[model samples]
Target: MKKIAIISALLPLAAGLCGAAGKKPADDAVARANGIAFKFYAAEAQKPGNVFFSPYSMYTAFAMAYEGAAGSTAKEIASVFSFPAKTKDLRAGLGAIKKDLERAAKDAEFVQANSFWAQKDFKFLPAYLKTLRSAYGADAMQADFLGKTEAARRGINAWTENKTRGKIRELFPQGSLDQLTRLVLVNAVYFKGRWKAPFKKEMTSEADFTLDGGTKTRVHMMAAPGTREAEYGETGELQAVRLPYAGGGLSMLVLLPKEGRTLADLERSFSPEKLEEIRKGLFNQKVKVFLPRFKFSSGYKLNGALAGLGMPEAFTDKADFSGMEKGKRLYIQTAFHKAFVEVSEEGTEAAAATGVAMGLKSMVMDFAVFRADRPFMFFIEDPKSGLVLFMGRMQNPAAQ
Candidate 1:
């Protein structure tokens, strides 16, 4: 007899209708909360140089895994991610956003995909699998982790690479997964879109960009073909602007620290509430835009960072994820994330992938020339949903 029983069997669902028995939050509130959570995440994980990652990707992957977690392990994850107090609400809210994002994709080449893989020999709770499949659109696929660890790793990496249009590769690094691995949850998000008003390639020129420490470096600065009307705002601390993508639904919100201030200063004081204030303060006006053309990729081993965010129990043996399976407990073994982004005269192309290996646990902008000659923060987001697709900072575009 089979140790694990497949109830409904994995089937593709149009949207996540995870079987949580509560009302979902109202009007993109879950996405907004995730955005706010990312603000706190940035404050904790950001370093001195260029930094980029997809909070959306991380949130979705973790949310899928969180569905299978039990006890304090689940509570810690909720605290760290700012998930809704009710499991049903969180699932419903995320499902709504997932459906909305799919609809929004018509305006841009935006794609988000998720999958859940379990060791075929292991026994997981049927309810856990059902919630993941229904609420997250992640069908459960049985993998031979004990006998084919390498093959399993390759299979997961290939799925991520394909979903991200070849932008992100090898999300599970060498030796990252081993025989003890029993489950893996993955999420990939990719976006390619042109600006509503693109900068003419001819207008791009070599310019001196000042670093926070008074160091100056040469960078290819892109300029809008001419003055354009965009969402703009400024406080005594910084200048902010919104550059819409091809569709008005999404935009890059850029925040530039004032002359006497530094990126660190802006980051240190930032919060989701503050971001809301900035969004409310913006006005539409014609402004000059100056952005640097840069491309870079960032990868992180998220165990330490996530622990620092107050979810230490998820990685330790004390973790209770019995909801995933009835027998031996599974703790997070590894959490990995990789992101790639390129901003240029034509538009922007960005991709990100996040993976959770059981054994496992883991872990924008804008414009305003509105000139980004100095270091600044940027976010690619859905103005209507208040979902931030990407968040990053450009310290030295010349670095990579």
Candidate 2:
């Protein structure tokens, strides 16, 4: 029995919004990663409440696809992601960031996995496969995508479920894969950590959580024990707080809109520079914190969203992925993603998985008395690298 190789790809994170002056290759890559994180957030925000997804997972999956793209296909991807000019540079930059993430994850449980699944008899350029193996450490697995499509789909889903500790399942869905599917690239990320100053269970109680339009609902609002010192800051728009995990390297950053300010206002003005400034302004202070214990999962077929973001060619016949194969040009067929998150008095656990079928194209916070009684943004990140492992907004903890 041939087994799929498990690649220790580490994970991804972000802080800076755009490419700043005097930055190294890895720093540039991280900045681009953060850029896409917000870009995707804006696209998703157009929809209604409670948006969440792992930027690192989605970025990693598409990065692999970009390796096998050529001509305008590659250019569009590079432009959308702000990828490094050279393929070798992109690989090296992402690899360096992965190592740093691994180092920072000692006190937390952070796992990243990548896989390349191909049609049993399909031929792909050795260089294309080599890039995935060497750069992303993704090992290939054979599947009869043209024959036993359902079995192939189930196998992939099972692998994803196991990798995510059962948090994500059925990523491809029935009929999502077909005979034209020649390749599938997958990236899954999982993070588990306990807050440094956890809220006492006794402090949790039912409270009214304000919703959009000033409507309210009951939620299990958790309170910090007395006045706990945390990284706190405030601006005219919002209040920010950093909740460190057991290991000092990773922490959750929460941004709560000011009393009269709407989350939409803070979101519209949110930028990398603003985030950096807020971070720089944070000071350790004893603060009263109230947050709702919430759990929710999100799923999306990112094809339309990616195309809308300026990479429409990747999904059409005009797309050129000749770098993957010479005779038959390949275009993206399907792009799928699923994510889950849980925030409680004890800690937080988040998992996300992304799959980009070659036939496809697709594709936080803060606090204050610091009370998040309404919708707020949150990020699970490596404070040092500014890598966001997971991020989302809590609209209604009562719903899930």
**Candidate 2 local lDDT, 1-400, one digit each (tens):** 0001111111110000123566665677777777777888888776777888888788888888888778887899888887876888888778867887787777778788898887776668888888888788886778887789889888888888888888887888898888777788888888788888889999899999998789999999999667888999888788899988887878889999988878888889888788888888899977888889988888878778889888988878778788777754578887888888888898888888888887622203233378899889888777777776677877777775
Across 1-400, the per-residue lDDT of candidate 1 in tens digits comes to 0000000011111000112355344354544445534554465435567877788777777877777777888898888877766778777777687776666556789888888888885767788888877777885677877799899888888888888889888888888888778888888888888898999899899999999789999999999666899888999999998988886877889899988899888887787768878988999977888999988887777778788888898777778777777653688888888888888887888888888888632203333457889988888877766677788877888876
Relative to the unseen true structure, what is the C-alpha lDDT of residue 322 in candidate 1, on a scale of 0 to 100? Answer: 77
Q: Distance (Å) between predicted and true CA of 141, model 1?
A: 2.3
Alpha carbon lDDT at 247, candidate 2: 74
Global Cα lDDT for candidate 1: 0.75
Off by over 4 Å in 2: 1-24, 360-368
Candidate 1, residue 340: Cα displacement in angstroms equals 0.9
lDDT score of residue 73 within candidate 2: 77
Worst 10 residues of 2 by lDDT: 7-16
**Clashing pairs counted in every model:** 18, 22
